[model samples]
Target chain A: MTVAVADVPAVPPDLLTVAHLSMRFGGLLAVDDLSFVARAGQITALIGPNGAGKTTVFNCITGFYRPTAGHIALERGDRSFDLDQLSGHRIARDAGVARTFQNIRLFPRMTVLENLLVAQHAKLMRASAFSLAGLLGLKGFREAEARAMSLAEDWLTRLGLVHVADRECGTLAYGIQRKIEIARAMCTEPCLLCLDEPAAGLNPRETAELSRLITSIRGEFGIGVLLIEHDMGLVMGISDRIVVLDHGACIAEGKPAEIRNNPAVIRAYLGEEDPRAGPGSTDAPGAGDGA
Target chain B: MALARAAPTVSSGVLRAAFGEALVAAGIAFMLALPLAGLRLPINPMDSVIFRPWWVVVAVATVFLGRLGLALWRARVAPSRRNGVPLLDRALAYILPWRRGIFVAFVLLVAILPLMPFADRRVIDLGAVVLIYVMLGWGLNIVVGLAGLLDLGYVAFYAVGAYSYTLLIIHLDLNFWAALPLAGAFAALFGVLLGFPVLRLRGDYLAIVTLGFGEMIRIILINWSSLTGGSEGITSIPTPTLFGLTFTAVPAPGETAFHQFFGIPFAGVHRIIFLYYLILALALLTHVFSMRIRRLPVGRAWEALREDEIAARALGLNPVMVKLSAFGLGAMFAGFAGAFFATRQGFINPSSFTFIESAIILAIVVLGGMGSQMGVILAALLLVLLPEVARDFAEFRMLLFGGAMVAVMVWRPRGLLAHREPTATLGDLSRGREPAP
Candidate 1:
């Protein structure tokens, strides 16, 4: 199912464009001259070994870290936001970029439904007139609250979490928690979804389900997905495009088949082995794929 | 005969362990009681120290017996753990199911207490004081309980409120009704002021800064003698009126006495009952506002921030604004209670706004369970009434209080009521298909 390079231009336009991104942590150049583009309505997987600056790229894109030198442009409608220039929360609030952490960062004590509702806080807050209307239980605020609840319910039902919707996030299993995190990010109604290591701790069956969920999210929401994953099987299975990174630089970029056969990508994963050794190596990639 | 022999072996092992544990506890108790109870220094240096060996003996004996009983109890309950739940927890489980009913009953009881035949002057006064603490606890619950900000100097805002009211009335000739909201606004302003510097701080560091701020306010009140009257305090501050009708036995010139306006016989109890109702109204307003806001977006944001600040930020919540609002609103309630405090006492002093008062209010919020309104009320009742009830133990009143607090912590470290009801539910709960948990 590999497509020719000439077919790329006919695909959707870029939703996120990262140009010459470099992040320096004192003596260590965590991300050096990294560049990639995630197109709208496409799944772009950033795959690399551990400490290959994949998450650094994510942090820069999500405004968690201000890159030492870079231009991160997020296109939405006619306006383009310079993400590196924005603060951590404004990136999500103004630029419509939502992300999940590598480690699940759900509101553990809060119920699953409340976690989703909290993500819609900004919208509901305005509709409630900062709580004056909510305090009064006015019709406008009630309608707004009902709307938010339905949105939360929609996501809960879609994720097959209706049964545990009332359960606290902390008490749920790891795979469920991961799915809830994605649902929570979707509640923000972002134009681009950034998932960091969504398949990190999932079993093969769970990873397969996650891959399907991510695919459906992109298809249904019509939003770009920027994924940072080490699960090569999941990535190779679902990614529309794959950008392979090593030593904070882009080693290769193409479709899954191209990346699978790319010699540099193999060396980056298998580490200095002969290129002809191929995918038959019994040894796991040093990237901690958890596969 | 064989069964009896096995029983003795098991009983002897248990007895030996219990005895050893009791001995250790008694030794520690002896050391602790040595300076506190065994010996006392003479007032005059020339006099020899007095010894109280019997006091130490009593302490050691009590410790030994207490430890022995505890060990035996553990030994007996360890095998059948089903019965090992604390008595208080068992009672709580039964009572918690009827929490809403209990709250209604509690409110109704307090409402009719002043009218009850058994209610005397002292009882009504105690009720007023408890209400003040209740209001303060609810206010601090927003900051410490909901927002997860430890504000050790909350009394600073209370002081600001008290001083704002007194100074407004004295200097500007303003009445209580007029000064009430203004006092709250001033305290909120101070809350925002304190919040600005501590926005970057969290946990223990935030607590230390707030503690300093509280002391700083008190010190400023003291040293600014020209305004606050130094440590001497301001006296004869005007009390609140029933819409211009003063609660006085004799009408002063143009003033109408409360009894005279109402055509009732003059009685001093009228004033006490009136003050009780005034504080009650203010506290009820605080409670209603808190209860309503708990389900609001801002309130959920506060809880979210408490649960995880980073997650809240990712959701586009401005931590600075949410925190400031918590501090401001919490301090505003403290301000209202402070104004009531000033009017109730008919005097204003820095000593009235002490660290101990702040500690007591914080304790009420924590012991009640953070962010639990009913918990605060129950905790306030326990804390305020316990000390008064144990007055017979005068010197040991605080000791009793400390012991009670320790016992509660041991049984329910998360507070008396830590369970949180979700702000909203979906599907089955909303549609009534399932009972609300």
Candidate 2:
């Protein structure tokens, strides 16, 4: 499961490559000619203003909506998946690309642990032998269930959700639920975790914690992290690279510093003649281009 | 004590509001009472035409006083409970912690009910009827509660089972034991058939489709006389034996009777009791099977799908397969119950598999607090026995049943036993704590 840097290219290798991906819905071009590479063991942030097709790009990458044209490929140590050719569930299951929704889609009625366990469904479902083994509590089923619980517990304890693990997921605070949603996605053991607006409704303190979480997700899990966030502080603080989009097209892609200085990103985000806001050099001072 | 600590101004406000509320309520009551009280519908309408304005005033006053009392009680009670959750909800929550114990005790009662001296022929028959509904409830619970599919045509599978068993026994000369599983399989096949086309539909649309499916089955059974016996229905289906031994006063030549083999005198009650136990066992099996799977991966996936299908897919659970399995398994259980029904009655008709039958079975699942086995049993007994107990007023029993259902819904909007026991837990958080440095 470990990917050694010495065994790969100097650029750290693009674990997920969205090459010329385009998506259209009826009369609307949701995403157009988007191309970006998220390296393994790195944090990549996709940032833009509203209706800039940030979510549409995530949807195309995660296979929720098939792109009108082009390829989204995920390359591991030796394995690869043409994500554009896969279905939504298969992208998560077979391609090992787990995603969380913009609105934090957790099974509200289920317990926190159950939500996490559900993410390990494919593993358990296989071990369940179509529920025959699981129903009878066979050795394999028990082991699979134990493994799922431990994984769930691991995420729960890490996210400070252990205290409310047995409580229904809907009752948790929004920030806590967001963390649970991330943890649930992690439980799937995804190779490239695509998070949609992880810091949407979070306050300053929670957003700070989310930055640390995203950094550690790359550091500890050694997996590529694609974060869709409006919180510039979160994005600029932790992101190794940033992809800027405007009107479904990629405007820029570079390190956080370069992305901040990119004129196209500033113009696209702050509007042409705002004059009041530029790409603030410091991290997330106020409503500016990166904000 | 907390209420006492509140300011005195609030009490004055409550007093004024109560009077205003009571006056409004009295006005509504007067309006409602006018038509009913002002008109007479006796056999001799001319002679019994009596309009007493004094009586109307007295009725309105009584209603007003009752409303005042209710308002006072509401003001006195805790606001927490007043927000739709009554003290009854807390009591129900308390009971939930000991649900396993309650379930065991309830099962024991059902197990021993047939052996009691008061278990007369009527009691045994009623027990069988309740058990049949209990089985159907558990079957439908899988489709409706766990999978969140509204299957209004569940009785189609029931009809499939009954007719399958009847036709098998008559044409193929198959025994009840041999035909039972076949009947279930046939129904399951039909379930898959229904599932494939309707997998794309959800909620109300799925319900409407299933309702049509049920009616279609009934109509087919009525028309296909050669195969299903049509409106005349199938009759004289052989009674299920105790391992090939019939419960008869005189055994068929070279065959042993149930009582004779047991060294007891042959009594028809033995057969009734046997049938009751049989259906009870089937119902218990259905409950156990459903319970066993709830903790498994498929079961978790089902509950997850019920909560949010998109999230379920994000986790890589196949919606179509999950839905199809639910439909097939749910229908299989219904088929088993239907087979048991045919055996118990020794006859069945298209009338038995009507839309009303589907409605009653569905009502059992909902009334039993969907997915709760104990709730289903309790609901089945109440629903099936209430009508029998109220046979003295046969026509009014349905009205009474509807009123009872509405009252329960108002009391427990989530169903009586809706406290969901989580399948996944990590023991106590305190117990799992590691020492902090």
Candidate 3:
């Protein structure tokens, strides 16, 4: 039951490092000593069973739920922020960590474009004195507004949401709404993007599009994408590195190929399926993959 | 009810395209048939129109237009992709120099209304008061409508503004104009102070705290007799003047005050007209300011916070700052109205600034439609005017008011004129094809 911290590899000199991150809710330990490094310009996938604490890790990292014990350090070019010490919104605005909810939390009443502009609120505040200076026509105020609008428009075009840019987010289809939510998150131009189940409700085609979108975002935008997806197809396809968690512990970590065949991962997927002679007692296909 | 059903999800464009012409057509036609209906002019309409009512020309026109609008849609238009009208289709889009239209029309209407023989002096005075309420409602709308924060103690700021003006002008011998801005400043400062604590509280908790805050201010106004005159109210407070020409001028023997100035009848009606314009300008200013703010990024942040706090926070918006600004800007308007209220009446008292006043202003914002300046103004007029118009129905007034409010809410839960949040880029909703899921 006691997993030694030293067993994990040394923390990488990456933009974000979570060392010994553990979150417990009363009797239930949601995330137990889960540690991972998110390098810049890469897609990192955290995949696990329904209750495997992938989202719990996201919540802990995003400051929605403060972990019981953890160290989350976020490094910019020169400055570093103690992510664990920051508040939820501060994690977003200050640490440049933006996240989209699993449930697609959008300002449904607001227009699609307004959703994006609002995401750039902090930057806009810096440019405009909370819009008062913008009103007074201060120098650079107009440029900031144009920048915000252009950024919003860019995301809208990228997501193919140009048509519904003025439409209320509530009125869009579930898939489109999800895309808008992601676009809104990107409009913040965060250093790290944490997407909780972005592909959860998407159809197969939509999921494929989402995969391309995530990959392009990392490759083009030069930002780290941390995704918690239930769809193994997406995780297996786009993720450069996969972190597998089982019952709040890191059961496996490597390239997708290595994690796919890890015996511990197989056992984690099918409990009581023997770690020894695993191919014989099969619940479904992929039982032999552990070989 | 049937008409409401037909236009259940009607957008602002549909209403504008169909409502104005329909209202005009219906108004004329209904007016012609009034004699046959035997409803008289029905000087002031009543809620009894709901049950015992014989209708009027205007009423019939509204019904007829509503029906025609529904029929036109059912016959001519096929189901399309667009959800709402584009901004280009707006009326202001059609006209040149549209900003001046409302202002010019307002000035003309105010100037001409008093000149009409049928326009009662009392009615003009009532209109002036309604304008003040419109100003207050627009101010409150910024807080409750745009920000989606329910403020029940808004009258506290109003009281603060009024007292600041009254006490400062009287005790310190400051000019009415000078105290006015200072009153607004003090009230706005207090708004920020109030915003700091109550910003964390949303919905009913925020309401209760504001209500408490309002009551605290009122209790102070009453108990602080040495300064406030303690319910006796500082009377004989000097009314505002225009270039040394006071509303009241001592008549030479048989000559009236107006005679001394311009050889006209001195009925004190000119003062009411001046007050009307003063408040009209204030209300217009409030409407313009709110409209401008609602289009800005901070304004969008307020709305985002209103809709989803979690999402707003995720967007990197500081909710505390947004909420406080809502309170600050909203209270500043209320403060402006409060200063005007004190100067207009030349009297200050605790009872005049009550929780009920706050409720009525809030009610106007709710009934008119939150986030709609025009809707707020219309609601203010309806709520304020209807009560005054129903002086004959005094015993049943409250019942009728409550019933009408309930009925309106039932018919339009969002408000009479719900406005969509403005976006930076207008989307073509028709092109939003929903892929089969």
- Highest lDDT: give the candidate number: 1
Ranking by lDDT: 1, 2, 3
| Candidates by TM-score, descending order | 1, 2, 3
lDDT by residue (tens digit), candidate 3, A1-291: 012222335633487899999999999999899888988877788987779898889888888788899899999778899888987888899889999999989988888888888898888887877677877867787788787887887787778777677788899999999888889899888999999999988999999899889988987987888988877777767776789988899978877667667777767776764556454543211332222
DockQ of each: 0.57, 0.60, 0.42
Is 2 or 3 the stronger prediction by lDDT?
Answer: 2
- Local lDDT at B237 for model 3: 72
Residue A259, model 3: Cα distance from true site in angstroms = 1.0
Q: Give the clashing residue pairs of candidate 3, or none.
A: B26-B61, B30-B57, B31-B57, B81-B430
- Per-residue CA lDDT of model 1 for B211-297, tens digit only, reads 999999999999999999999989999878998999988878999999998899998999999999999999999999988888889
Instruction: Candidate 1: list runs displaced more than 4 Å.
Output: A1-9, A273-278, A281-291, B1-9, B40-48, B82-87, B427-437
User: What TM-score goes with each of the models?
Assistant: 0.95, 0.90, 0.80
lDDT of each: 0.89, 0.84, 0.79
lDDT of 2: 0.84
lDDT of 2 by residue, B162-202 (tens): 88988899999999899999999999999999999998899
Better of 2 and 3 by TM-score: 2
Better DockQ candidate (1, 2) = 2
lDDT of 1 by residue, A1-291 (tens): 334333656789899999999999999999999889999888999988889999989989988899999799999989999999998788887798999999889988889989998999899999999888999999998898898888888887787788888899999999999999999999999999999999988998999889889989988988999999877777777788999888999999988877777778878878774557655553323222322
Scored by TM against the true chain B, the candidates give 0.93, 0.86, 0.72
What RMSD does each model have against the real structure? 2.9, 4.6, 10.0
Candidates 1 and 2 compared by TM-score, better number: 1
